[model samples]
Target: MMNICIKTVLLIFLSQIPVCFSYAEFKTDCSVPQSLNTKMILFSVDEEYSLYSPEVIGLIEFHFKEKSFINNVIQSQYVFPGNYDYQVIDKDLAIISIKEVVGNLVSKYQILLVCISDIQGYFIYSLEHGERMPNVHRDTGLYILR
Candidate 1:
């Protein structure tokens, strides 16, 4: 009876959460390497200042001979809106910061990259800072690391 009750409660809790799908395609022919030279890309879907919140996407890439590390962002309850930027603070770490203007409000969001090796060859993380943003950000917990 206890086992059945636990399973029923687990099913009920999970049922309330939304499902999200992710689609990724790799077009590169490069082979996986033990180490990489790292590069990052951060951008918003739009620059328009309106009542709406735009989507922010971050990409961290690791290349052959490039060494990189990662760190976690300081936990904040305040959500920031805007663009993203980064600086390599150490041989294996980089800090990414966000600042943008939406209407009269200047918003900010940030993340730190600390190191971990995944099977995919590099570490990637994404954060969607708004309630109405795409479900993919929330479902994936915005992090993909190799």
Candidate 2:
């Protein structure tokens, strides 16, 4: 009888292992254009593609080109996703710059890809504050979608 009880207890404990592991996995979904990898959560962000004044997009690409990882992220090829309901600033409509001046260029447009992931988990993590791994041992590169 005691042997049977011990076997039953062990069986229950073993059965719970997978559940425990699943919780530890800490997986989440990466937004549009972003693909979750073992290292970074990469997704695209949208902005006006102006050749005359490329400052807006330049700034964003410049940062990533540096390839700096913290919390949990890495470097990769970036791309635009789709058209979005993006707007520049909290203002009116359409910004047509003559030369170098950034103000309200975005009026519900382009969708860019942004990919990011956790170095430790190899799973998609939430970009929010609490969604990060409990104890991130390494630097995770968390980039904002422009």
Candidate 3:
């Protein structure tokens, strides 16, 4: 009887090992994105693209030169995924920008892309609009998208 009790206890403990490991895996999978200085949580590409209107996507793709940049944006967690303003600078140039407010402070980030060419694009982040250039020297904070 004692042998059977020991075997049951061991089985229960072994079964819980996978559960613990799974929880750890889940936490890592949903982990936040990283920035150079500030803490920012950019949205997942799939979420951003899906949230964007079809027309907006077309407009962005139309002037965005770097196709890979779009893929990178979609795959990267560099900007918050939320409402944005799109503007057409030229026939083949466009910008997508967003503003995020934390407490009473607001920050802006923009993506400049070419519509018809395969040129490289840029991701810009700043505490104020037209106040500072986008670089790795800003104090960004935790970005959470649900």
Among all candidates shown, the one with the greatest TM-score: 1
lDDT of 1 by residue, 21-127 (tens): 22222223333222333532222122233333233223322211233223222232233333445566544445555454656654344445443332222323333
Q: Which stretches of candidate 3 lie over 4 Å from their true place?
A: 1-79, 103-105, 115-146
lDDT measured at residue 115 in model 1 versus the true structure, 0 to 100: 38
- What 10-residue stretch in candidate 1 is worst by lDDT? 135-144
Task: Estimate candidate 2's RMSD in Å.
Answer: 17.8
Which candidate leads in lDDT? 1
RMSD (CA, Å), each prediction: 14.3, 17.8, 16.7
Regions of model 1 farther than 4 Å from truth:
1-81, 118-142
Instruction: Say which prediction, candidate 1 or candidate 2, comes out ahead on TM-score.
Output: 1
Per-model TM-score, in order, reads: 0.28, 0.18, 0.28
Tens-digit lDDT string for candidate 3 (1-146): 45555556766677743222222333212211111122222321212322121111211121122111221133233332233555665444445565544455455656543322222322322323423333222221222221
| Cα error of candidate 3 at position 132, Å | 11
Which tens-of-lDDT digit does each residue in 48-139 have in candidate 2?
Answer: 43332222222122212222222211233442221212222211111111111124332221222222322211111122111223311112
CA lDDT, candidate 2, residue 123: 15
